[model samples]
Target: MNPSDAYLAHMDAIVREKVRSIESARAPEQEHYLGQAELWQRVADHVERYRDELSFIVRDLHANPELAFEETRSAEVLATTLERQGFVVKRGAHSLPTALRAEWQSVDFDPRRHRTIAVLAEYDALPGIGHACGHNIIAAAGVGGFLGAAGIGSGKIVFLGTPAEEGHTGKEYMIRAGMLDDIDAAVMVHPFNYDLSAHTWIGRRTLKVVFKGIAAHASMQPYMGRNALDAANLVYQGIGLLRQQMPPSDRIHAVIDEGGHRASIIPERAEMSIYVRSLYVDTLMDLSTRIDDILTGAALMAGVEVERSWDTHPMSLPVRNNTTLADRWAQTQAARGREVLPFGVLPDSQAASTDFGNVSQLVPGIHPTIKVAPPGVALHTKEFADYAATDAAVTAAIDAAVGLGQVIVDTLCDDHLMNKARSEFENAGGPIRATDLR
Candidate 1:
């Protein structure tokens, strides 16, 4: 067999062995609070009764995919669905044209006296691969969670539809607009290859480097012009070399946006976009400084003026998972017959960045993953996108919604758990403005 085929076979064998080991391992017995078990059961029953509706929403979103910041149709459909279900819906929330908000509160509950939780929904699809991220599932599950838990408990539940999570940090914008100021906790689930109680989501920042130079005829007066393309090339190479010295958890990638026109003419201006990611906010800032130095050195060597801009959109912070909340979710998912692995069981290299990280920093939260596709299926691929529409994905969505709803109910009814979550958030240094991280 060829080398590629051999490598694939070897990796598949390893994956199968790992799965067998995981399945054979004993499941941990989690502690549960006796906080209105009847209400929690009602939430689960609500999700079960509304399962077909939730599945239809996911399928509809999958059939019609929209990209970041332009998810008008998705937003409309979600808002309308919530409104029809008797939720007070608000479109264009937080000054975002495509963002949505729906609120519901039990009759005996007062927001001033009790805890409040938010269930976040992200409906934006990737540029070319539509629904590859399984945002459709996220949106439907979020709606189901809000509907299932709204009247079952005493506290207020907010269903937030955040747009543009693919590249733009819509939650960051909403945070700045005071969307999450009154929230106490947040919860959301993402579709993945494996079920996880909690997973690491790293921080990410974007940089745009523009180089300016004089243009002249390449063959005649090469000496009279400084090539901006040369600066871009130097910067790209410097970043590549810097990768060797970077930490294993850090990542840097770049793409040239403007590299000038004709070959006969010396390039006058060039621009390149680069993304830097790290597992911690402090590490991300340190890496940003290194990238800045490299860009400056590249400009100096090419004899060109360089301009650097960071985070044209809001940067994503690393997520902080509240163990108390995660435990509640784990118990709920266990009741549904899914065994969720703890954090360290999966390879940290599989982590990705999300706008929800910004919200998590502001509130105690749990962003769990529900298994939709089989093992070895990575997200944002056409294969994953196709699987997102299958019956398995729809079923996973219903289960995730039930879990999220039950967790919300638990958080609201169990005062001890809510207090523990708040204490954890406070001990973690609480919330900070995203722009102030640097």
Candidate 2:
């Protein structure tokens, strides 16, 4: 047998065994807080009634995909849908043209005393594979959750349409613009291969290194030339060597953005773009320092000057999952006939980064993953994008909406749960700015 075929056969057996392990694994049990059962029923009823409209929204977004910071049509459709549902809509919110804010409050609602919760929506698509990340599901489900919970007669429900989640940290921009100043808690759901109430999302920062050197004729004065490409090559090798000493959770990847124009002429400048990720803020910072030192050393060895910049876009901090909120989410999902797994059940190697992580560090939040595809379907692929528009995804969206709406109701009605969530947030070092760590 061919080597590639043998490797594939071996991996297939390993994966099958892992799948069996996950299937037999049991999630820890937790007591559910006694929230308003009647109100939750009302929320479910509203979701059931609005099922067709929600499906239309999800399909529409999937058909007309938009990229980050350029989701004008997506935002317009979402805003119009919310407006038709009796929400007070605000377009161009948080200094972003594509961002939106829609709110619904009861007649006697008092923002001063009553808790306020925000349901977030992401509609940005990937560059080539549109909706491969299933953000359309997020948008539709969030809108459904807000509308479903609108019938409650206490607290506030705000549906925020956040764009640019694929590459740019749109939530960070919104946070800096005071979009979340008065919000008590945040909730959002992402489409994935499994039902998970709490999963790990690591922190990520971007680095750009530009090497400046002198150009000279290759045949005439090659010795006088300092090749910037040499520096890039050296740094690339240094990062590979540094990987063995780094933690298993820490990741660094780079690409040569600009190497040279022609082979005959010595390159005057070269640029590299790199991404650094870690499981915690402190570890991320430490990794950043080590990467900087490596880049500087590469420039010194190449006898070239180097300029390094961090975070061309906003950095994404690791998500701090509020157990109190996540448990409520798991309970609600259970009622939907889904067994939502807690953290550590799934391999941490399956983790990815998200802008929602930035929001979680600022407020008590839960970013759970709802099942939209089969167990082995990977994200950011055309197969996943196709599944994102199927009936299975629609069903998951409705179930997720109902679950998120119930969680909001619980947060607003059950003071004990909210207090416990707040305590957990504080204990996790409460509202640390992502910029401060850098």
Candidate 3:
């Protein structure tokens, strides 16, 4: 039988009550050192002036969606736009053909005294679900953000176009190729059902387990042959049992890719693909080890040889949001008449991972969510894809761009805020070696 919708209704009710309670309380004010009302007004005005152009970009991308690592047209549109705005554009940056790196600096820019901020853009679509994740909105917002910050400050701004965020880790690869080497901080926004200051994004690792056994005709010599499908079934059941012992913040899911072809023949080979997730990096690693043990046990019980391979793509780390930067984002959104809720105010039980998490671990960053759809609309769905093409999504994209631009302005001008952001990153274990995750 299918699951009941009662749980969904109950959770929705609980979230509504919690949101009301949180909104009633007054939020603490964030202090500004160098940024003023005029700077924010200027940025907003710049983004507002190009509203039509940004909307066109969003609609164009949504209309012509491209999958990960194949976003040639999408990348070309973004790159051409940035280049027209006087930004030096480089296609195929950091060894990725579809990636981009565009930069603009004020005349007084100095590496010694000023900071460099990156505004990241993602434009990759999912398989058979064009722009369901709203990456088209991301691409447009990032472009608008960079345009707003252009020629405004004495620091530099980079518009980075990252590709393939669906199942592959594009940011991680760019980082390995020196993408974040000179970047002081990074900021971006994602489209979601609600406006959030900091949403929960967990760590993820993919594993592929293969079982090998002798094949024989079941009716002729079934007892003489070992069944690899039996071992695969044992592993699947073992993982289901493991779920009960797992922590509430951890998640595991698996699928059998190969099994016996016919009942009369014992299968020679079988395989299963699994995804393991956890709220923390250490816990994610521990969970992977436990899962490996389960696979080994299943192989031993079924008398089959097992082969385990992990992370055909790069693993995504959990996001460590810098509090100082996130506070500035909240202040910006509030100025636009949107009350951005804090992290814990929303339910985090249903969470996903992002390549941005890896970017945050390497540099202090913020990946807030901007409201584009209703509360009941979830991401990566046909319904959400429909919403992504609407006029409301264009509005959210503009707001997100203004918010990110303001944050970049604040980080470049305010020494106190930058110092605090760096300190917060250090306190949370700064500059993780992504290669050491294994």
Backbone clashes in model 2, listed as residue pairs: none
Query: Which ten-residue region of model 2 has the weakest summed lDDT?
Result: 1-10
Best by TM-score: 3
Worst 10 residues of 3 by lDDT: 1-10
Question: Mind giving the per-residue lDDT tens digits that candidate 3 earns over 30-79?
Answer: 45654567788889999998798789889999999999999999999998
Candidate 2 ranges with C-alpha deviation above 4 Å: 1-35
lDDT per residue for candidate 2 within 259-285, as digits (tens), equals: 989888788899999999877776677
Q: How many backbone clashes does candidate 2 have?
A: 0
**Native-to-model Cα distance after best TM-score fit, residue 431 in candidate 2, in Å:** 0.4
Q: Model 1 over residues 1-438: C-alpha lDDT tens digits?
A: 331232243345435545543543445554456646677789989998888789988999999999999999999888888888877788989979999998887788787888889999999998889999999999999999988888876778989999999989989999998889889999999999999888878889999989999999999999999999999999999999988877666789999999889999999999999999977666677788889998899899989999999997789988877766876787788889997886658887887899888888889999999999988999999999999999988888899999999999888888888998889788768886687887
Cα displacement (Å) at residue 355, model 3: 0.6
Pairs clashing within candidate 1 = none
Q: Sort the predicted structures by TM-score, highest score first.
A: 3, 2, 1
lDDT of each: 0.86, 0.87, 0.87
